[model samples]
Target: MRHVISLLIENESGALSRVSGLFSARGYNIESLTVAPTEDLSMSRMTIVTTGSDDIIEQITKQLNKLVEVVKVVDISEAAHIERELMLVKVRATGKDREEIKRTADIFRAHIIDVTDASYVVELTGNQGKLDAFIGAIDPALILETVRSGVCGIGRGDRVLKV
Candidate 1:
């Protein structure tokens, strides 16, 4: 199953490398990873997305705890949580296609952040499904480029990951 593992780690050089190294050395695959400094400047928060069975996830969590920089680890997917990803798509937008693209973006509630004579850059934020659906709605031939920010997740009410 897919898991969203959040970690609080010391915000220092090589901290991210060590965490990623652990997964690499263990032959585990990380589908997506997002890391940034938290409110506490001394620490950073990392959200990792991966697929594995319950046993595998348990093993990954235990190994993560062993890392010196990893202050705490939690599989937020275990309980109620909220997850979002940001995607930016550049698509051909001219003639009739331009109007169609604008309509499609409005339907998805995405913003046309940038526009030119021949293309537009659409910014969207939502769950993976919603983003994927938007991509599906657009014609592949019209798509110029796409960029997505990996999943960022947090536990629901009362559940939190902290040092």
Candidate 2:
């Protein structure tokens, strides 16, 4: 099964390394990771996406708690949550291809952030599946480059991850 684990940890050097190292040492594969400083400034929120069995997920939670720098860890996947990913794709654009790409971008509600005589850079944000669908809709030969920001997630309603 897939899980979205959120962690509140000290915003200190090596904190990220240690957390990631733990997963690596245990042979757990992290599909995506996003970390950023929180409002407190002294702490950071990290969202990690991984897949494992119930036993494996339980073990992961316990091991994460063992880290001294970790303030709290929650498997947001257990509750109502929201997740998003950002992707930027540069595509070859010329003549009819340019018009078609523009129409596709509009249909996806993506922005044409940059444009030139030979290419167009489209910025898109949505769930992984939505992003994948956009890519699938485009011709492979037209794709020049792609950059994706890993998943970022948060719990819904009054459910907040705090110290």
Candidate 3:
């Protein structure tokens, strides 16, 4: 099964490296990884996506929690949360293709952030599936170059996961 591991860690240098090394040492694969400074710049959060058996997932969480630099670790895959990712998609579209591109973007609610004679840069933020569908719809007429921000999530309702 695929799992999402959300980690809150000290914003000090080498901290991310240590956490990443743990996965590397165990030969686990990271499908997606994103790190950003939290509201408190003294800390940062990382969301890592990996696939493994339940037992292996449990072990990964336990070991990650034990790391000194990790202030909090949560297996958000099992939590009730609102997860989002941001993507910037640059699509190569010329005059004839521009209309089609705009229509496609409207369907996805993606906004055109930049445009040139040769391309349109669209910014999209949503769950993974929405992004995938948006890209699929425009791919035929436009060549794509993409940059994606890994998952950022928040818990649901009155419950909160605090560091």
Candidate 4:
């Protein structure tokens, strides 16, 4: 099953490498990873998306705790959580196709952040499905490029990953 693991780690060089190395050493696959400095300058928050059975996830969590830089680890996917991903798509937009693209973007509540005579860069933020649907709505031939920020997730309500 897919698991979203959140971690609080020391905001120091090599911290990320070590964490990723652990997963690589174990031959596990990481679907997505997002890390950034937290409110506390000394620490960072890392969100990793991976798929494994319950036992495998539990084992991975335990191994993560052994890392010197890791202060906290939580499988936020175990309960109610909120997840979002950002996607920027550059599409050919001209003639009749331009209006159709605009309509599609509006329907998806996405913004046209950049535009030129022949192309538009649409910025969108939402869960994976929503972003995927937007891409699916557009003609593949018109898609010039696409970039996505991997899943960033946090537990809902009282659940929190912090020092």
Candidate 5:
């Protein structure tokens, strides 16, 4: 099973390293990780995506808690949650392809943030599926570059991950 684990940790050097080390030592793999300082700059919130069995997921959470810098760990996947990722895709747009690319971006609710004579930079935000679909919809040869922000999620409704 794939799990989305959210953590509130001290914002200091080595905190992320320690967390990643624990996973490396345990031979668990991180599919995606996104971390940034919270409103309180002294702390950071991290969303980690990993695949494992239920028991392994539990163990990962337990070990994360054992770290001194780790303040809180929540398996957001265990509850109702909203997941989102951002992607900036640059595609070749020239001649007849220009109109098609613009139309496709509009259909996907993506914004053409930048445009040059031969390229368009599109900014999109959605779940992984939507991002993948957008890439799939474009001609592979037209794709110039892609930058992605990994999954960042939070519990839905009234649930919150408070440190």
Candidate 6:
């Protein structure tokens, strides 16, 4: 099964490398990953997407917790949460294609951030499926160059996951 692991770690050099190294050492594939500094610069959040059996996932959690720089580790795949992803897609566009792309972008609520005679860069933020659908619709009309900030999630309602 797929697992979304959210790790809070000390914001220091080599910290991310160490975490990623663990997965590499075990030959586990990371489907997606995103890391950024939190309000407290001393810490950062690493969101990783991977797949494995129940026993392997349990082992992953245990090994991750053993890292001294790790503050917390959470398996959020089963949590009640709201998850989102951000994507930027640059597509080839010309006069008529530009108009069509703009119209389609409006439908997806994606903003055209840059435009040139031959191409356009669009920015979008939404759940993964919505982004995928938006990209799918735009791909046929133009050659697409894509960038995605992986998944990020927070618990639903008033609940918060404990560290």
Q: Tell me the lDDT of candidate 6.
A: 0.87
Q: Candidate 4's residue-wise lDDT over 7-91, tens digit each? A: 9999999999999999999987799999999989999999999999888999999999999999999999999999999999999
Query: Model 2 clash pairs?
Result: none
Encode model 3's per-residue lDDT on 44-103: one tens digit a residue: 989998899999999999999999989998888787888899999899978778888888
**Which pairs of residues clash in candidate 3, taking residues 3 or more apart in a chain or in different chains?**
none
TM-score of 3: 0.94
List the candidates' TM-scores in order: 0.98, 0.97, 0.94, 0.98, 0.98, 0.92
RMSD to native, candidate 6: 1.6
**Residue 47 Cα positional deviation in candidate 6, in Å, after optimal superposition:** 0.6
How many pairs in model 5 have backbone atoms within 3 A of each other, for residues 3 or more apart or on separate chains, i.e. clashes? 0
lDDT of 6 by residue, 73-134 (tens): 88887777778999999999986888989999999999999988899999999988999999
lDDT of 6 at 60: 90
In model 4, which runs have C-alpha deviations exceeding 4 angstroms? none
| Residue 147 in candidate 6, Cα distance off native in Å | 0.9
Query: Which regions of candidate 1 deviate over 4 angstroms?
Result: none
lDDT of 4 at 10: 97
What count of clashes does model 1 give?
0
Q: Whole-model Cα lDDT per candidate?
A: 0.95, 0.96, 0.86, 0.96, 0.96, 0.87
Q: Give the clashing residue pairs of candidate 1, or none.
A: none
Q: Candidate 1's residue-wise lDDT over 19-88, tens digit each? A: 8998999988799999999999999999999988888899999999999889999999999999999999
- For residues 52-76, write the lDDT of model 2, one tens digit per residue: 9999999999999999999999999
lDDT of 4: 0.96
Model 2, residue 163: C-alpha shift (Å): 2.1
> Candidate 5, which segments miss by more than 4 Å at Cα?
none
